[model samples]
Target: MEDDPDWGEMVSRHIGPHQKLRLHQVASVPEWAATADLSRYDLIFIDDSKTSELREQTIRHVLARVAPETVVVIHDFEIPPYQNAVPADFERIAFSSFRPMTGVVWRGARWTMPITQLAERIDARKHMSPLRHSAWRRYLASGTGPAR
Candidate 1:
């Protein structure tokens, strides 16, 4: 997890000896590496607390670099501070958006992901054929229609 200097040390200390952790002070997202070999990690979780422009740029960078199978989980999706903060350009690229039916109080607001939308995506992906997988991967890479 990428974080500010103050939080990095505390987070690393709490994770303890068995876990591996590295801390780097980066002023902005563009300063970070443009590519990452996702084969080493099962999931990449992004906490979207930055400005809309930075968040969109970071998402695009990650999407281009990570493998198709890599699970990219983003937080603060339903939080008011983050919801509309996502720029129009990023929203256009996303295939779908979700919000929860049940809300949880966090940061003084109730936030959630809609259960129906989540279930639909889960079901659709589950039934996807090998061809479909390949097509979706291509779509993600090129930001265009699925492969023929």
Candidate 2:
């Protein structure tokens, strides 16, 4: 859920009628959760909340109810707090080459094949922004470095 209506509307306008999606601007993640069915979604992507803890909460919230095949991605995973947000039992696939860096996680191993195919299909290296920040440098130096 987006917090700003104007930005959300702009995004919706950019999305146009091509994508089968609806963007909602909710006051908080909890508000959106109140009416949405997590299990029915095949994929879930949340814009990073104002804080890392909130982002983690949102990530865990989806994992708790979504299907095993569902893939959830959130932003700013290159930061240590965001990386720590991932629970120990789950495996995270990090793409630290991107500007904000992305983290992909699911509750079980069912995510492997599809993510692997997607990684193959999407050439992240070509789209990679040059690394300039210390945070990203540290993330790349760590074991959870980008697949590319």
Lowest-sum lDDT 10-residue window in model 1 = 102-111
lDDT of each: 0.45, 0.67
Mark the 10 consecutive residues where model 2 has the least summed lDDT. 120-129
lDDT string, candidate 2, 55-133, tens digits: 7676666666666667778777777876776678777777654457777887677777767645443344335445535
Instruction: Write candidate 1's Cα lDDT for 20-89 as tens digits.
Output: 4444456655335265554564445554325755665665566556553445555544534334433332
- Which whole-number lDDT from 0 to 100 does residue 72 have in model 2? 79
TM-score of each: 0.45, 0.70
Best by lDDT: 2
Residue 100 C-alpha lDDT in model 2: 76
lDDT over C-alpha atoms for residue 142 of model 1: 61
Which numbered prediction scores highest in TM-score against the true structure?
A: 2
